[model samples]
Target chain A: MSQTMPDWSVLAATCPSRTSLARIANKWTAMAVSVLGGGRTRFGDLKARLDGISGKVLTETLRDLERDGLVTRHVFAEVPPRVEYELTELGFTLHEPLLALCRWAEEHIAEVLVNRESYDAR
Target chain B: MSQTMPDWSVLAATCPSRTSLARIANKWTAMAVSVLGGGRTRFGDLKARLDGISGKVLTETLRDLERDGLVTRHVFAEVPPRVEYELTELGFTLHEPLLALCRWAEEHIAEVLVNRESYDAR
Candidate 1:
């Protein structure tokens, strides 16, 4: 029998969904997902594409995504081992909303900058 | 005369838009925007509705949103005083995406939790 799911609201401090919102709303996570949306990527490639991300933070972010089932990691054995990360099916569902936020930031940065300058002048 | 806008990509290390993304993608900012989406709200009401947010953090979050032009703060001169916040047109545009993310988190928390448990078990 199907059970009724608990109503979840991120606004509620005690809701478990708050944790999920925190994870997905993260800056690094947003950037990482944006990059990964291109296709499967290697660790170094992801690090490079993400600009200023540190190797440690990238590792942590990917591990967290993996734990959350939003990303999958693959390790290949070779003369030198290789690893790749790709978004899972569930992650693909999240890509659009996440990418839209990134695009919004890019599109509105000019307006936001002007607002910041004016606010600081006051 | 109109000028061509420079390409702004969040994936770029030096892009200004990354700062905007960081602000909007913030946990408190997400929750604050979600609450303010209901319409104008008083400071006390906002604090109460957002659950465990500290007064200082809410103040800072509101100030940041105000600076970014995503929210407006109003002060009324009266008996004691009245202060309220409401989203600007730009903020209203952002509300849909931010709320979608929050709803996504709420909708997916169960799957994420199950993934965490199984991943931790392995």
Candidate 2:
């Protein structure tokens, strides 16, 4: 695909931006980005922090983030090899918005729960 | 469940906030809220603006948003009975972040596509 358009819009159904939005809008992606914002973390450590994430799911999320140029994985040469994952410069730009979203969820859960109960009652 | 802790963390495995995040972090929910930010829109109109959304998915997304108290549904007493959807006060608060995420996707898509191509080649 050659680049002709100077702008992309998510509202456009066929726009590739929708695919990007789909990836980043995922709950696991949000949490992973939020956690990785702290600093570089090993795969196991990342999974542990995310809580309830299956190893496979966490690996896929990280791989997707890596493929998107958002996260980088590093391997250290040693008798016992170690791996670490960190946000790239581009990923850092994403960190703020995603973290803001996580904060929003946490801050508003009380009201959302109340609403769910009432809505379910009706 | 009784309320005790003041803080709700999505990082916690079983926190209700995760459920809330899971709901709002959905791509369809994000798109729906972004479009609804314009003002009240009929169901068909909302589906149209969202682009590529099926009627069933759009209906379910709106219902979820309504149940979460982030959206309000109004039914007009008319010959045919018209219905429209609008963001509630709480939903308005969600608008900024979700829209930001969508904008990020649009703005960063070129870079992401490039990254995907390069990653896939490896």
Candidate 3:
């Protein structure tokens, strides 16, 4: 059987789990982590892939993800200096569950939209 | 193999999947669904379980969840009138993945918090 959250798990006001979920729940963070799925990616490239994210949002998202331990940022001291991002092991675990959520969203998007329209019309 | 989202999956502006994800990603909705996991739950019970959500927020969240096809509302025609909410099959599927996320958050909250504190000090 799959896991069931304990009664007080996320209900607690100070639960970090709630904060943790919030981190990935933002689509920008979710997509950023998605892009890094293949392997580590450069900062410029990660930003490029998101396409719709503002530079500030992307910067903040990456910093937050790194701070949350879901992503790691590497900086090299070469002339041009290199900065790339990768998922930590903890991040990979999160990515799997998160990807499942994204897939569910895509597959059921039509039903959800139809339901929304009718519900709103009432 | 686990499902991987398509390249353009969540990157598009018109993606309903992103909207759907956004709906449940809100902690209020997430916790509400978690409470209803046992079976059908009444509005008062669900609201009480969440503890911190405003009456307005609970109303809005339930309406949104119902609209998105993740939850069903049943109104019993009686003197006082009765209403209960239960997960749809689709919602149940979502609950599984989401519970995993909640569990992940609780289990690793400490690590993430430590990472955050250290990251901020730098």
Candidate 4:
């Protein structure tokens, strides 16, 4: 478990939010969160949505999301057992910003590509 | 030097933007960019704006910013030598989103603090 430091500094410090930022900026996390934005989803469903993510990394990301309070995980007691994850209100709040980033990446991708060619040619 | 793969995959990959996201999400980067939003600034000026950053880390961060093209560095021929950094248009474009994150952090910081306490107690 990570140490729980005082609240004031966590908000003030960049290191603390580095983890959160990493989570949001992660390819899998962003895609997972975006897919979850549709509604609640099971682990397998999420795995299907994001192709090529190792099971280990996916599990780790999910745990981080739960720990950070961005997503809620509910486990059911049954024969096959069921687990579901969904975004909290706070998580939902992050959607617009994350979406904005995705939109920016999509829109400026061509420009960024052009810049890369010029940047590399030099 | 980090490997420069094809341009398309970079925009598509999470790992690539992880560096850029990490750069923007960094406490110092946010603060530095915010300060630079005022206009061009000297290296020492940026160091002053962000407290507690070591010179090495600051230099590294500046290099990263320049490499990513978020900042432009100008060196002057003089007795003492003068260097300045200012944001590019793309860097300026990133300002609003970064500011939004800072504003969100400031506003919800109290709520996040409360959540932390409750979360720890459990």
- Highest lDDT model number: 1
Best by TM-score: 1
Winner on lDDT between 3 and 4 is: 3
| Candidate with more favorable, higher DockQ: 3 or 4 | 3
Give per-candidate clash totals: 0, 0, 0, 0
Q: How well is candidate 1 docked (DockQ)?
A: 0.90
| Global lDDT of each candidate | 0.93, 0.92, 0.78, 0.66
Which runs in model 1 stand beyond 4 Å of their true positions?
Answer: A1-3, B1-3
What local lDDT does model 2 show for residue A94?
Answer: 85
Winner on DockQ (2 vs 4): 2
DockQ of each: 0.90, 0.83, 0.55, 0.16
Worst 10 residues of 2 chain A by lDDT: A3-12
Give the clashing residue pairs of candidate 4, or none.
Answer: none
- Tens digits of lDDT, candidate 1, B1-122: 99899999999988999999999998888888988999999999999999999999999999999999999999999767999999999999988888888998999999999999999999
RMSD of each: 1.6, 3.2, 4.9, 7.3
Candidate 4 lDDT, B53-74, residue by residue in tens: 6789888877766666778889
Candidate 2 residue lDDT tens string, B25-117 = 889988999988989999878888888989999889999999999999999999788999999999999898999989999999999999999
lDDT, model 2: 0.92
Against the true structure, candidate 4 reaches a TM-score of 0.72
Tens digits of per-residue lDDT for model 3 on B37-102? 889998888877776678898888888899888899999998788889999987887777666666
The full ranking of all candidates by TM-score, starting with the best, is 1, 2, 3, 4
iRMSD of all candidate structures: 0.7, 0.8, 2.1, 4.7
